[model samples]
Target: DAQAAICMVRGHAAEWNISADKIGFLGFSAGGGVAIASTMSATQMERPNFLCTNFGPSLMPVTVPADAPPLLIMTSADHPNVAAGLVALFMEWKKAGANAEMHIYGDGTGPYELMPETGETTTESWSRQMLQWLKSKRFI
Candidate 1:
């Protein structure tokens, strides 16, 4: 769970010179499940400072906390699996009065292809989008 990870980091923070507040979570697919779990966990320490979900499931209901971490969500409009859920989650988060942002990519060509790290593909640029969000929050 995120609690263990956060605690470990916090425990070594002084020697590692990394602040607990700067730690965040970014997840894709199944990993996003974990991210969501971490965000909605009852233990505050288990939560990340910020979170990014890339085309993840949204059915896991959570009571958005006042201190809910900033969130960035992305999904291809044409994605066969999780696009609708991701968008639903974006709206849900907004309605929950949480700090949330979303991006729905893809054109007539269908969802952007997930290219290799060295390759430049439209869907692949989603990583850059995440980075930009992190930058806006001064996480990078």
Candidate 2:
């Protein structure tokens, strides 16, 4: 899924007059995990035996720029696994000198779900906050 997404994003860069080297990925929940895994795993030289043989096409080289855009993640503190995974991913990005930030909200009113109503406060305009972060990073 990550490879496909990256490929598709890269494939469209030319039409937008944007360089693929400048593209960055943002994902939520399960998609977040996949994005982290994909960015790292795409650099491997050997194919894993666990993957199906029928998988088509190797991706473009994983060239995480020295100035790669920031990664922002929001997870629930009540969900330890989600928090842990995000922290670990953050550590990896930090070690690679890639910018990343994560927020784990305590006492979230919802679990693993995004609220649609105006009264929702768990995620509390997380999408808006993400947009702000992206704007701060010059990604938008």
Candidate 3:
């Protein structure tokens, strides 16, 4: 079902005048699995130029392609149940020789807050940080 997003992106990438090469996917929580599935899927166009998971589980036994796009994993120390998963994912990507970066926010309190405004709490500032990450990837 999540791959539908990828399919939709591929279906409309050109019509929308967006460069497919600049395409990327960002997902939160369970949506993170979708983003991973999209990137790991066989269809090339569905594989975004970048894959980002915000406070989501880190995938395992995934065969990252040689051309795998940069991967960004964001998590919070407050969520002990999921914190280690992100690190596992980072290591998995590195083991597979994929470009990866991770940002661990918060100080052992609070939850993952998506789409935080520019001047909110540390959890809220995640969205803003994502923008900077995009720029660093030269996608902006």
Indicate whether candidate 1 or candidate 2 has the larger lDDT.
Answer: 1
Decide which is better by TM-score, 1 or 2: 1
Candidate 1 per-residue lDDT, tens place, 23-70, comes to: 788888767777877778736666778888876764555666766888
Among all windows of 10 consecutive residues in model 1, the one with the lowest summed lDDT is 107-116
Cα TM-score per model: 0.81, 0.63, 0.81
Q: How well is each residue in 70-137 modelled by candidate 2, as lDDT tens digits?
A: 66766666666656656665565577787777666665434334555555555445666766876776
lDDT, residue 109, candidate 1: 24
Model 2, CA-based lDDT: 0.53
Computed on alpha carbons, the lDDT of every model, listed in order, comes to 0.73, 0.53, 0.75
Residue-level lDDT of model 3, residues 75-117, one tens digit each, is 8877766677778878878888889999887654444344243
